[model samples]
Target chain A: MILDSIQRVLSTNELVTAFLFVGTLVWLSYLISARLTRGQVHGSAIAIALGLVLAWYGGLVTGGNRGLADISFFAGVGTLGGAMFRDFAIVATAFGADIKALKQAGFVGAVSIVIGVFVSFLIGGIVAISFGYTDPIAVTTIGAGAATYIVGPVTGTALGAGSDVIALSVAAGLTKSVLVMIGTPFIAPKIGLNNPHSALIYGGLMGTTSGVAGGLAATDPKLVPYGAMTATFYTGVGCLLAPSVLYLGVRALL
Target chain B: MVIYGVALLSFCMLTGVLVGDLLGEVMGVQSNVGGVGIAMLLLLVLSNLDSRKLKLTPITEKGIGFWSAMYIPIVVAMAARQNVFSALSGGWMAIVAGVAAVAASFALIPVLARFGKGEHQ
Candidate 1:
């Protein structure tokens, strides 16, 4: 009777179960991070990677949308991983810095945004070409996505690219964001990303605000504002450039 | 006091989302634009309002501190929800494009740093 009751309670409280599940995943990831990677790779990065693996497996097994959240028991994963909490966490991280420090990197931040957008666009565009995506719209959309996830759809919609190509653009940008978040802490020392100015440049160059913000938060919370500020500008600059000057540039080349 | 911190964050988030949605509508995009970024800015501005009367208590500061460090779990959950496998299965082009773009951008950091004036380290 007690066993049946426990099962009923566990099954009913989905969100609680989700917390328990994600908590354990995080615990296991930290253990692996400490023993295997010797703490060189942050626990958060490992946790995210493991979560992605679980998501892939969940998709394979269920063959349903919403990833692991599709399973009844894991149904709460959808709400737990939804945008509301994501934005809440991001806002929490933003509380760690000072606005006064943001003023120190003005000119460098602007230059980084322009150069960052162009470089990412060039690299993404070149790769798209090499991969046989010869259409200017496809190349431009993906190239803008390489700038940031936000810019990708904005560019795609503005250019009237097909839905599939726009989806690809979003995926490309999401991949970039995850990569930046996971790679930041490991590369911080080598890149001299220890200051506000460098953080500003890094933010602009990286262009994805969430990626830069998360990466900087992991590496040094104090630098989040500087990096996030320029990264924000990067998206605006990308949206302006991608569908116009950048798209025209691609057309000229193609 | 802790409740106040949560209240402050909630207020910033609501305002940010509204502004982000408005901006998206203005820009003709169908999604909220820069909501989190705006929320962060709001928190920064509100917390540092430079008024002696408005200064946060230590308990409220601690409350904010607690939530700030809890971003890891949220990030993990967000990662779990992304359908990366399907996205990758679309083709090798998407993977190559993303990885190359981030890699090339990373490589340019030092060069850009040199041109950006003093690091003030």
Candidate 2:
């Protein structure tokens, strides 16, 4: 009777249950990060990879557009994973920072964000055209994806790009995340990525929050927040530019 | 005290969304642009000010910290929503585009590092 009541409660309060589910997943991911990767790969990156796999599997099982949220038990994940909460988390991360430390990054950090978005978009756009994706929307979406996964989808959705193109953008962003996660430590010493200023600039340039956070964690745990803060800003800047200024530029070029 | 933090966060969030929507309209895009970013800026500015004048209590700080720590798990939830299979099947172009972008970005880090030197003090 107690078990039945517990089950009933969980099913009814789906949002709380979803939180529990995601919490468990994050816990498991951290365990894997600790044991398997020995913390070279950050837990956030692992959690992301695992989430993607689970999403893929959930789709196969349910054949739904909402990914894992299609399952009734996971239904509340739709809201939890939606833009509202995503924004909330992003904002909270900024709240966790010390601004006095941020100002220390100064002009270089600011410049890096603009340069980072532009360079990534330029490279992504060129590659897309080389691949024969001439549609301005496709090129722009893919290029934005290079900026970050969030930027890609946000740009794609804003521009009303096709699903296939959007999917490609997501894939591209994911690849970038994995790369940064694996590559940060290897390159840290050579680039002088030791200080808070460099980390802030690095975050702006790299722009993938999970990637930069994971990479920085492996490099120096103290630097994760600095990198993550700028990375979050990078996402915002990319979203602001990709669909508007960048799209116009790509259209003109094509 | 915790309720105050929640109220402050909510206030920032709502205002951020409004501004983002306006930005989208100005830019000719149909979606909210950078609302989360704006919200973060607001929270940062507000909390910084709070530290100086209002001095939020530890309990409120704890509330904000609780939400802040949710960053990783929330992002995991966000990750779950992405359709990786469709993207993988979309084409090798996706892989190429992504790898190339990151590779180029990685290469430029040292060069970018050069411009910001001497400011670290």
Candidate 3:
């Protein structure tokens, strides 16, 4: 029965697997969060556990071929979402912040994600067309998971075209993760961008841009700590709802 | 404070999931757990926050608002691929879902904000 269940799960498409991974993460996150809330666990433990699980599950899902990239992409998305949500919370709760601010932030974050995804799609399409590629024009959902987790792989998948998009996305996500880790802190300080919230946004944009850039330069591992948190949070939210939401949106338009 | 943050987040998520599930069961609506979690968290956080600082520069506020609106269309456009409106029996159902999501966020924020305040008093 156990073996059967494992097979059933593995045989399913990437979306179902993505959902299962997220659901598990959410549940684990809740457990960790609960422990922290009860003063039973340190925040560092939570962070470590998150990183470890991310690495492990990411490897498991993407396998040896694209595991690192997939892990990085998903982690990036989650970190971005979490950071945005955290900012919204902080703004909403801060003595000087208000409903308008909260509303505005939420709006901005959501819109940014939409714009980002659309832009990525447009770029992917143009690249495919200019190169005389014959892949499906529709945004590939398989890579979306990797893209949400690891931006590089998604970008790779986008530019790599058709059959190898998954592999390309995975490769890209890993490379981007490394770059963002190295660059965000240094760039942030130089650019006068500070604070955890801003750091999160900066990290996300870096991850996104790195995915666009592919494996150009070596990324720093230190930024991984910061970017991982935000990426996981956003990726979690997006992965969970993207399919249902996308389905609804497309149906309405057609 | 960290413990409290974790506990509150957990409670909000659990409550949101439960509430969303109950509502889904009763109404046959397909509300998302994450959305509920977000709404609940917002409510809890906002309620405990001081009301005086709810301000931002107009430009910043506008930027945020625009981003928030941007997600809706992407989600809607993607959802359209699934024939979501037809499943709802009409476009009105989709509108209703959108309205409910927005309303839930707005209503819960203030109500939760008040509840958090009452606890302190």
After superposing candidate 1, which stretches have Cα over 4 Å from the reference?
Answer: A1-11, A64-66, A213-226, B24-33, B119-121
What's model 2's lDDT at A26?
86
Looking at candidate 1, what TM-score does chain B attain? Answer: 0.82
**Candidate number that wins on lDDT, 1 or 2:** 1
Q: What is the lDDT ranking, best to worst?
A: 1, 2, 3
Q: Model 3, stretches more than 4 Å misplaced?
A: A1-101, A125-132, A137-147, A150-164, A190-192, A195-254, B1-6, B15-40, B43-121
- Give all TM-scores, in the order shown: 0.86, 0.79, 0.36
State the lDDT at A97 in candidate 1. 74
Interface RMSD over true interface Cα atoms for each candidate: 2.7, 3.4, 17.7
Whole-model lDDT values for every prediction: 0.78, 0.76, 0.34
- Best prediction by TM-score: 1
lDDT of residue A119 for candidate 2: 89
Model 3 chain A: weakest 10-residue lDDT segment is A211-220
lDDT of 2 by residue, A1-254 (tens): 99889878877998998899999998998999899989877776677667767777777778775667777778777778776776665566666577777776667887888999998888888888998889999999999998888889999998999988888888788777756755777788878888877787788888987677556655665676567666766877788889999999888888
What is the RMSD, in Å, between candidate 2 and the native fold over all Cα?
4.0
RMSD of each candidate?
A: 3.0, 4.0, 17.9
TM-score order of candidates, top first: 1, 2, 3
